[model samples]
Target chain A: MRGKDVRLEDVVMRFGSFTAVQQTNLTINAGEFFSILGPSGCGKTTILRMVSGFIDPSEGRVLIGGEQMNGIGPAKRPTALIFQNLALFPLMSNWENVAFGLEARGVAKAKRRDRAYELMALVGLQGHEEKTPNELSGGQKQRVAIARALAVEPAVLLLDEPLSALDLKLRQYMRAELKEIQRKTGVTFIFITHDQGEALTMSDRIAVMKAGVVEQVDTVDNLYAHPRTPFVATFVGENNVLEGKISHIQDGFAIVETQQGAIRGINQDKATIGDKAMVFVRPERTKLLNGAALDNTFEVDFERRDLEGAFVNLFFKSDTGSIIVHEANLGQHKELEGRAKIGFNASDAIVMRSGELSDE
Target chain B: MNSLIRSYGKGLTGIFVTLTAFWLLLLIILPQAFMLDQSLWSIDKDDQLGMKIDRAYSDLGLLEYDAQQATGDTNPAVQEKIDTLKEEIATLEAQETDPPREYGLQNYTRMSSLHFSIFVKSIFYALAVTVLAFAVCYPVAFTIAKLATPQRAALLMLGLIIPYAINELLRVYAWLMILDYQGVINSLLAWMGVVSFADKTWIPFLEYPGSVFVALIYAYVLFMIFPIYNTVETLDKNQLEAAQDLGGSVFLTHWRVVLPHAKPGIAVGCIMTFMLSVGSYSVPQIMTRGKSGDWFSQLIYRQFFETQNWNVGAAYAFSLVLVCLAFILIMMKVFKVGIRDISK
Candidate 1:
């Protein structure tokens, strides 16, 4: 079955007096794997529920396949949802669980059972049609949930952190598996997750949300390389933030004066001179100076070092705040200690107008 | 036993074991055993024993008078007759005081056709009450368990339980007041010009067996609802949404998901309701007020109190116990739930 586009036009959701989602317009193209990435309680799940027809937006309309979805319930809509806990009916056999949608539609038992078997096989779960959900492992239950959602031939499939319950390895594995299934089925998948890594790994485009507002929506690479907001820059990945005023502005870069000294970075937000700004640089991009000249440099006393498997995080402390410099874990830096100079090129850093930074 | 000792030490363990054993024997086993023994025997009452004793006393008095009137040689003969008569009176008195007991199953076998019909009717009525109670209580239980907000659910539960704080007989009497000839419903009907109090043209609700059924269901509604509420409360809300998301209607969702999950509770509720209604004496007695025929429990009561025959009462009571046991087994089978699940 082919996928269809989903569009939320000026949609807003409010519960009682509390607004869960701000007014927003978004268009998800057909057959694209889109992800809404945010921290917990950021209204991403609210959006998923609205799209799945569980809750109607308090304002505006939700459209699927160019048809208005106002006042339509989840069952009548062309979307299916996979809950976070993978709510598989424990009393039913695996095949029966997969065929529940067909049964609801009044399909004959034998035909539905055959279709269930086919769908189960599609998820690589053959020869286990009669096994109950409790008899299977966690991942198998996950597959059964997916097959159940697919049985309805929905144009859009909405998943709300379905991998959050698995262990790290299984979660990483399921990311690729989900991506592959989305590719083969060519269904518009709207995945909601708080894990930026999962979104980056699986999504064609990612929408970063914060406090009931959509911060930015772009491709995975663009969202990471050129985040429009300070929240997105720090939330999408780790960043070293320096708050200061824009002292100078050039063609496309700005110099910010801070307690750590003057630092120049790309002015993505186009901050004017004398405006408050924050400079953000990835830890991996910052390097040990070792007398090499760079556009921006600072001297800091080494505070601590953490050894990761493939990378080493060297934490340095200035009078202002701590700055982490990430490097590959080579044997050269095994004996390094004390004060050191670290630097990064101006093009590697970004400058935006001062705004809220992520607390975590 | 070992675990008890390990948990509570030897002294408390001994007390616990002894108390449990005492409860088992005194509260459960001994009473049943006594009923069984009583049911097994009937007294052989000879209706002529009192007359025979009176006759023997009169004969002794006459023989005494004859002895007093006879001469020396004739007096000895008369004295011997008097002695024999006295002995006969003593034997007749003893027989009158303590009759012979015939041990057999005659009490069970000698049930009259009318009483047996009442027994069957009682069973059938109890079954109906069970089904109707389930139909009424299942939706209420599910709403309270899964639909209502927490405070509203608590309020609903409190409302259900508040009536039970009063005595059961009082509650049944309250139903009597509501359904009596000139009671609440009929009075309201009379005021509405549907029926007239002056002409005595009021509906007789107590005359129908349904009145007793309604009272029985109202009396034991909690027995049916609480178990189901408990089971349904534990169901995850996500499962419901998942079914709806899969296009399952409300009926299908409950039929396939909620009902299956609540099998044990439903079985328990049916068993409790059936047993309570079948053995209910006061509810039918109060609700019907002698307008309808006697229930099996009322028949058993009459056999003991009015008929003054404990043996037949025990037999009828034991029969009811057997029927309840069979019903429990049937419910367990139909619901596909084990005893362990019910206890939970």
Candidate 2:
């Protein structure tokens, strides 16, 4: 396709001896909203800056629209950066700000003014041209900054934590607004943030970064349902680990030895004997069924139960370990606190090698 | 009452203002009254009579009586001399009756003829100096406020303050050494073959009151530059970038964005520069050797000290003060902000 596709091949960035973003490789298809998600100081913004041409990759190269960005400066590159603070010019009228790029290109003033009006209307800011940046509310200013960046019509729009400054309510509201804008513009959006929920909610694909390296890059569903690494499992969504070693294997099940007992799990990989492994079970996937049939059950006393809007986070304080059992909508089960027995079926568990994830 | 004192202790503004007025009246007004009284009286530089003496001479009538009595002793020559002495005595005795009633509008009118012109000239000089200083200082001020690094910024600031701290005469004289025909600049030029050692090379430097403008402006330019610089410094750098990003060229950006922001400082600088330059006689005197460069101050100085006319001098000084006041008033109206705002 002629549309822009981003490719980062073996990219490494370092500050002094501290390597931030090391030998990372990822390719994003055109029109996909890819998010680089991590905790603070995980080198997510650094990667975004490199893609936007604000920063040069210390090693390797970045390709957009199948062209190598060797000598392209930020202005010349077909990329626009939205700063964390939004970086809206405070002194200009909203209309003038959007028309800035066209003015630079020696377009007639009337034509540029009209273009600004059109973009403002598209971003739901039609009647607010005469107002300065400070006069507009935070969300409005954000939309204006977006309009100004889009005025150039760049191939890839780089967002560096644009929603981090907003309050939680506003942040949630802008998430939908940003998605709508992305769809309307039809531009490749490369968003960088530290919020996992935000990434999962809006991104077509999510790349989890840790200590400057991309741990995994995949669709959010794949990341949530089947995490290849424990870091991804822990970061993408909450998944509990039951430490064990493969005791025996069967046709569709494997028994893993642990302090609780030899637990049965669906053997997805058919792990070898005496191979140290972990049984990864989602909190919701666990059933505390007292009256149903179960292949495996743990004789554990209950620690506590937390009731959220639609589910409960059940903490099981056991000698093996404190494992969380998330029960979705515990209706008519108010007496199951203080101490209880929990049971689950073999189909609910997936076993893995103990060292499948690095200590990072 | 104790609580009242406690509450109003820091709120002593009204009391402080009253005290200030008392001091101002006691010191400023009383001294000004004495000066005004002195300005009315003419001083005798010739010292024909004692300073306190107001009585006319009696020898004036005695000379005439002697001349009439001397038929044998006094010859035609003695008579002629006596007649001359009598005329002088009568003139002095007649002055005693009127007591040199040269008061009121006469002194104020005398200012109109000679010293008044100097007042007008001083105001003009000050205005020219303000305009000239603005042209020379704006670029330097802009550079210091916008571009200089912290250390270099300090140095640029020192560049302004160092020259200002020097006595204005010395500051002006410093320029004289550089601009003079045989001084440092000419000597350097002579080595460069631009002009010979024997050639009078300061011909261009004298063109259009160059020495006067240079010395006067250079001596006081910091006064103008700092005020403008102060205003421009806090100006948001983002504003300039925004203007450019909004399609303004360099000149348009300065006009539409930067100049309006710096208006208050410009007004303050203009007022201060104009006030100082018009009243300054030393810089122009030293730089131009007090000859061809005689501005209005020279005339006022001559009127008060040389010609012994205090009335005309006061009138001239007053007129110049009034002119500056009028200009400041006009400026305040144009800027539409209080003086205190710009001063800060």
Candidate 3:
């Protein structure tokens, strides 16, 4: 089946008196794996529901393939949804569950059964046609749900955190499996999840949401390397934030005056002088200095070190806040830990106007 | 037993077991056994025995008079005759007092064609009531379980249960008032000038069998609704959305998803409704007020009280029980649900 682009123009959603999604404009390209990443109650699911035609936007228009989708119901739309719990029909056999959409369209039993088997084979479930959903493992059930949604030949597939129920290993495996299926089918997949890693791994582009507003939408690499907002920088990945004011501005660089000292970073938001700003540096970008010069440097007392298989995280107490320095576990800093110096390059850190940070 | 003892201590466990056994024996088993025994036998009473006893008494009185009037030798012969008559009277009185019971299946086989037709009609009417009740209740149950808000669902449930607080006979009587010859509907029609009481022309709702069905359905509606509501309430709402998202229509969604999940509840509802409607005496009795033909339960009532034939009544009642049991089995088969599921 060919995929179709989905576009939401000035969409707003409200339930009674509470706004679920603020006025938003988004366009997901055809055959692209796009993910809306946010925490619980961030209204990412609301956006999926609107695109799937489960709910009409209270204010704006939702269009699929350049056709207006107002007043359309889910059944009449060219979209399918995979719920978080899988929601497979427990009483129906796996084949029957996968073929239910065909049955609803009045297809004959034998034809639908063959189609169900074909789709199940596509999802790597060859010998599980007659077994019920309860008889299958969690990952098997996940594949069945995907196969069921694909059987309808929907132009767009909406998934609502379908992997949150699986264990970590299975979740990671399913991420790749889902990405592979999206490629094979060439269906526009709008995946909703709170796990940034899942989005970073599986999505071609990610939209990070907070409350009812979309904070930033960009490619995974750009989102991690140059987050436009403090919330995005903090929510999308681990960041060592230093609250300060824009002390100096130069060509594509700004110096922020903090309680500890002045630090320079890339002027991503282009804050004017004397305006409040925050410097965000990634843990991996921050390094332990050994009498070497860097754009931003600080003296810190080592608190502890945590070994994480391949990498070691060295925590240090600075005058302003705690800073973490990540290094490969080569067993070099085992004995010398009382005092240390940490620094990062000006190009490695980003400076943006001060805003809300994600508590998590 | 060991678990019970461990949980409640031996003394309370003994009491619990004894109470359960007592309930099983006295409330469930003993009555059924007695009914079966009563249905198996009929008392055989000779029609001529009473006349013969009267004749013997009169003849004995004459013999006594003759003995009193005769001389000594004739008196002895007359006394002998009187003694023989007295012995015969004693045997007749003994036979009259304790009639012999003849055990057989005659009580069951002796049902007339008219009564048998009523029995079959009652079964069919009960089946119709069951189907109609299901049609009426399934939507309401689904609305309460899935569609409505929690407070609204609770309010709707309370509305459904409020009528049950009154006695069942009173509920049937309420229907009777609404469907009588000059009842509420006719009165409304009369107000609309459809019919006039002055001309003695009005709809005879009680004359038709529909009135009884209406009453029976109204009386046993909860039996069908509550079970279905309980099962449908447990269904996850996400399953419904999934079906809809997969391009399932309203009919196909319910047919393939909601209905299968509610099979056990539907089976239980059907069983209770069918049994209650089939054996319902008060509904037809009060609704028809004898203006229409009788139900099987009414016939059973006649056999016991009016005909004074307990054996035949027991047989008829047992036949209804057997029919209901068959209906339960059929429902279980049709719904593909087991007894364990129904209990849930």
| DockQ-best of 1 and 2 | 1
Clash pairs for candidate 1: none
For candidate 2, lDDT tens digit of each residue in B60-129?
3565567677787556876777666656656655554434534354445545544456566667777888
Residue-level lDDT tens digits of model 2 in A122-189: 88997899899889988898889888878878788888898988888988998999899888778899
What lDDT score belongs to each candidate, Candidate 1 first? 0.93, 0.76, 0.93
Clashing pairs in 3: none
Candidate 1 lDDT tens digits, A1-360: 778999999999999999999998999999999999999999999999999999999999999999999889999999999999999999999999999999999999999999999999999899889999999988888999999999999999999999999999998888998999999999999999999999999999999999999999999999989889999999998899888999999989999998879999999988899999999999999989987789999889988889998889989998778899998988557777898898899999999999999888
Q: Which candidate, 1 or 3, has the higher DockQ?
A: 1
Candidate achieving the largest DockQ:
1
Using TM-score as the measure, name the better of candidate 2 and candidate 3. 3
lDDT of 1 at B159: 99
**Cα TM-score per model:** 0.96, 0.72, 0.97
User: Which tens-of-lDDT digit does each residue in A1-360 have in candidate 3?
Assistant: 999999999999999999999999999999999999999999999999898888899999999999999899999999999999999999999999999999988899999999999999999999999999999999999999999999999999999999999999999999999999999999999999999999999999999999999999999999998889999999998999998999899999999999768999999887899999999999999989987788898888999989999999999998878998888999878875787888999999999999999988
- Chain B alone: TM-score in each candidate? 0.92, 0.77, 0.92
Off by over 4 Å in 1: B47-98
How many Å off is the CA of B66 in candidate 1? 5.1
